[model samples]
Target: MTKIECILRPGKLEDVKDSLNKYGIHGMTVTQVIGCGLQKGRKEVYRGTEYSINLLPKVKLEIVTKDEDVDEVVKIISQAARSGEIGDGKIFTYKIDNAIRIRTGETGEAAI
Candidate 1:
């Protein structure tokens, strides 16, 4: 199994989710996060003053899939999130040693 972690602009969440669902990836975890990359954040104006927003808001997705599904999943996310801009975000994939379902005591891919 492979674990795919995606950090994307908040506005792209819905599109990414829909694409993933249509592609048969139904399980995922989503979180609101704040971080900076090469974009180095951006400036914002509030109350007639300019402020450097060092950490921008982003959406983080955690999805675990069978090895064969890894490439497709990445492609789906990439297409859905692409904006041709600096802060479009990134995807990271890693090997998953095991997955266990506590309720049914299923392990390995069955748990996934």
Candidate 2:
């Protein structure tokens, strides 16, 4: 199995979710997060002064799927989330050892 994590602009969440559903991926975890990279954050004005906003808000999406679905899942997120600009976001994919469905007591792909 594989776990795909995507950090993206908050506004793009719905598009990403819709695309994932279209691709037959249903289970996911969403988290609000703050971080910075090449964009280096930005400056904001509050009151009459300018301040450096070093960390920007982003939405983190976590999806787990079987190995064969990795490419399609990534493609769905990429197409739905792309804004052709910096800070648009990033996606990370990794292997998952196991998964369990707490309520149903299902495991592996069935659990997913």
Candidate 3:
């Protein structure tokens, strides 16, 4: 199993979600987050004043899937979230030790 986490521009959430659905990836966790990397954050003007917003709003999408699905999931996210611009987003993958379904007491791949 593997866990894939992607952080991207908030505006791209809907498109990414739809793409995942097309791939039959229906389960995921979405979170609103704030952070900055290479491009850092951008400056904005509010009420005639300029301010540096160091923490840009981003959407974090997390999904757990079988090992074989990792690459496909990452590709789907990348294709959907990309804007050919900075702050498009990033994806990270890691191994998942195990998972269990509480109600049915199912474990491992069966639980998923």
RMSD of each: 1.1, 1.1, 1.4
Deviation (Å) of 24 in candidate 1? 1.0
What value does the lDDT take at residue 12 in candidate 2? 99
Worst ten-residue run, lDDT, model 3?
34-43
lDDT of 2 by residue, 11-50 (tens): 9999999988887877899999999987786889989799
* Candidate number of the best lDDT: 1
lDDT of prediction 3:
0.92
- Listed in order, each prediction's TM-score against the native is 0.94, 0.94, 0.92
Cα lDDT for residue 49, candidate 3: 100
- Which stretches of candidate 2 lie above 4 Å from their native place? none
Candidate 1: regions farther than 4 A off: 46-48
Ranking by TM-score: 1, 2, 3
Q: What TM-score does candidate 2 reach?
A: 0.94
Give lDDT for model 2. 0.92
Worst 10 residues of 1 by lDDT: 35-44
